[model samples]
Target: MSCKRLAIIGAGSSGLVTLKHALDRLPGWEIVCFEKGGDTVGCWGNPYPGFISTSTKFTTQFSCYRKWDCEADPASRAKREDFFRGAEYGHYLKDFSGAFGLEKNIRLHATVDRITKVEEGWKLWMGEGTEVFNHVIVCTGLAERPRKVKTHLPVLRSMDELPEGKGIVVVGGGESAADIAHRLAAPELGNRVYLSLKTGIRVSPRYHPIRGVPSDFLRNRLMLSIHRGLRNAIGQKFVEARIRHREKFERAFHANPEGHAKDEAINARRKQWDARLTAAAKDNLFNVFHTKSDEFLDDVAEGRISIIGPPKGDGFREFSEFDGEGIIEIEPDIVCPMIGYTSGLEDLTDGELRVRDFHLGCLHVRHADMFLVGFARPIIGNVPTISEMQAKLVISLIAGNLERPRDLKARHEQERERVEREFPLLNTEALLPVEMFPYCDQLASMLDILPTVRKVGLRRWWKIMRAPASTLHYLDDDYDADAVDSQRVHSPPLITGLLVLIKLIDLVYRRMRRRASSRGSVCPG
Candidate 1:
């Protein structure tokens, strides 16, 4: 097969940038991008309707042009906490596509149906025609399809259809659920809204408590190092418990003894939820993915909206069987399931790729030409950077520059085990959120943007040893096209040694765990 043409599906953030970089790295190579939406921005195509972006714009925004560097609005420039409206974000993505000159290569409104192996590399069916390319990259972000849980009331999936003078129950703990709850708690809704959480979830404010700075600013290399240090020093469980307790500890800020009678009333309202709804929140306080909330919790405490549902535990049961009084009260004017979307794995393949862990959930070993990007759903942090890093890894692999594990099967088995162990609560359909710091660092190391520890300067190399996490620091406009050419280019000794040491440690750890479990040692259950 001649490696002359490349086909990228989905013109989302990942696909768009992949197209741009491929052009830059592989000049004159024929690359065509298929986007089902008429416009390049996938989620942003109907951006105004998705409510607001939960992630802060500054860090979430990916750019090669540095376009957002100079904001004309004084208020926005001075304060980075304010989020952009959906329309604004859509425009920004469109601008990014234009800045990178990707419009020409993007075939708008093109939907890929299935891909099959071909003598030339792979064959694809897109609508009325068929095409084949040397490589195929799926960049569709995780919005596969909305999971529907049949409720007594008609599930209201759209925000515009929300009616006043009716009770609504929204089931979820992610951005969509929080956004809907906050909006429904408006005076017009008559305070008859409820949110049902199924797992421990964090409801975080847009800005930090003391500094009033955006949370994205704090998500840096230092924060990653701190996270690793805590995980190491006290263990992951302790660190997680501390995080889960953070919200409960913040009660001191709200409970004021010297306040007016109205303050006492608000506090009392908060207490009302103490027995009924706080069960999930208390357990999941720091356990689940954090949902960005500006007013969901405040409204809940003030009796504007009520909370319902038990978290994942012995108390927890399926939603269909749940007969919580809160659900019975509203009877639910409309049930909204804000649970996240799934990756459309079925559409990507007709054979062989059905059920297997694609390299870190991106690369495929059975059919090496297959690549799945923008599928990882991190519980926190923005996704564009993940998309970028994943794309970088994909291109590097395709070019034959990166090395596979000497014992590829062993590595894959270990990775699979780790994923399943780390997230026991997540179902098979749900994409478990990755630990961003190390995942991104591993991708960066693979790209050689930062070399293995032994090859770099002492200080720079030490940082990698600790954790290679930084957002804006690693964006690259160009890359070496010949990176995938060397078959013998194994990873540096540092990377190799680190992997081996980690395996040994994990082996011992798992053995201890098995022993503990056999002895009926306590688990989260």
Candidate 2:
């Protein structure tokens, strides 16, 4: 390690992108990037077969160079040019490393044994040798550590490693659980699968079952804003069924009930299939977890995967009771828990959330020289783009292109409030599960690279405040040096005006009701 040289830990998507951007921005600075694994794809490097981008390809690429065709033929099973399998995506990250000349700067197979803050800088050690760099960017990734199971039940990195044809119970429902269930249920494996999940969390489909559109294409925040305002204006009675929170959270299911499916028999079968979900979740078909994969539900319906969980009633054990023989009583020969995500963490204390000291988005609040990237869960969101945005901010801070006060009192106060609010849901310092668009926008604003696309023009406002969307909609924005100016960003949206009016009306009504009650007269309905 040398002075003025930047230390980049991990050659994943976030790490590689940060390295490329830093090199271009800081010509005179020295850099050394490290990867424990020999390859550069990070999580996608050794992903299971047939694994593809769960979201639109656009959402999974760096902003300046996301050339993947997002509008490709979704129906093609032959692996079209738009969405890609995991192997191809890994190759894409490798290409980025080569094209950006990052390979020469990277030292593969070098694992840092531990890191400590020293007087010179951050000290990263491998065995007896140690190196210190002026600045450190950690891209170890959110899911670097699989959520641990408390008991000593059998565990594995992938479900494919499960004993063939053995009964399996997958615990803690999430994308990982779905991945395992799908693999086990495939015709070749034919292993019985069971899923355990918490009720009331959402299970979103990759695509709209009826529209045949990928879920990524339709989860627009703008759509949510407009729908909310319109639904509020139209009265709750009229929109109650349509505007339910469950459907609102999951756009794919919303589209399914609105139109006709090409295959009538398939649709009927799907409804019959949905009944199982309603029964298992114990809260109607739509009331279960707000984020589940449709493929997982498909397995549940076809009986390929049996589900064991507590419904919306009493009697559901948090996970499962361990038997007296030091084994989980579940009969599955293999038991896997698809739990939470963390960054380079050993384990989580059942309910422990530490507030990380970070300011201006991803920079260390106290250790300003330290930058963190890819440390948050993109839970049902985007990681590549989010990581890229954070990368931009880190480089900007280091290069002196971004300026702010050293004491971030206001910002720190807000961070405290945010942690207090979000602690109930997730208990990790670096891996906050923020919604995609707002998170990106917040970071982009901090970096002073406000894309004009988010400005308050009628079109932009419509896109921002009124569209059902995935973060993919915000892709293709230029993040070059010329693009990083606040003047280029437009003012607030039209919804602000409507919100002001609504607030006034609400205030006036409250005053009238108070006055009537004070006078001992009933307020008019």
lDDT of each: 0.60, 0.59
Question: Model 2: how large is the Cα RMSD against the reference?
Answer: 8.1
Overall local distance difference test of candidate 2: 0.59
Per-residue C-alpha lDDT of model 1 across residues 118-178, encoded as one tens digit per residue: 8888888977889989888888767734576644566677446666877777777677777
Against the true structure, candidate 2 reaches a TM-score of 0.74
**C-alpha TM-score for every candidate:** 0.75, 0.74
Per-residue error at 128 for model 1, in Å? 3.0
Q: Model 2: residues >4 Å from true position, as ranges?
A: 1-3, 72-82, 144-153, 209-211, 224-292, 310-330, 345-355, 405-409, 452-525
- Summed backbone clashes in each candidate are 7, 23
Worst 10 residues of 1 by lDDT: 481-490
Residue 13 in model 2: lDDT: 89
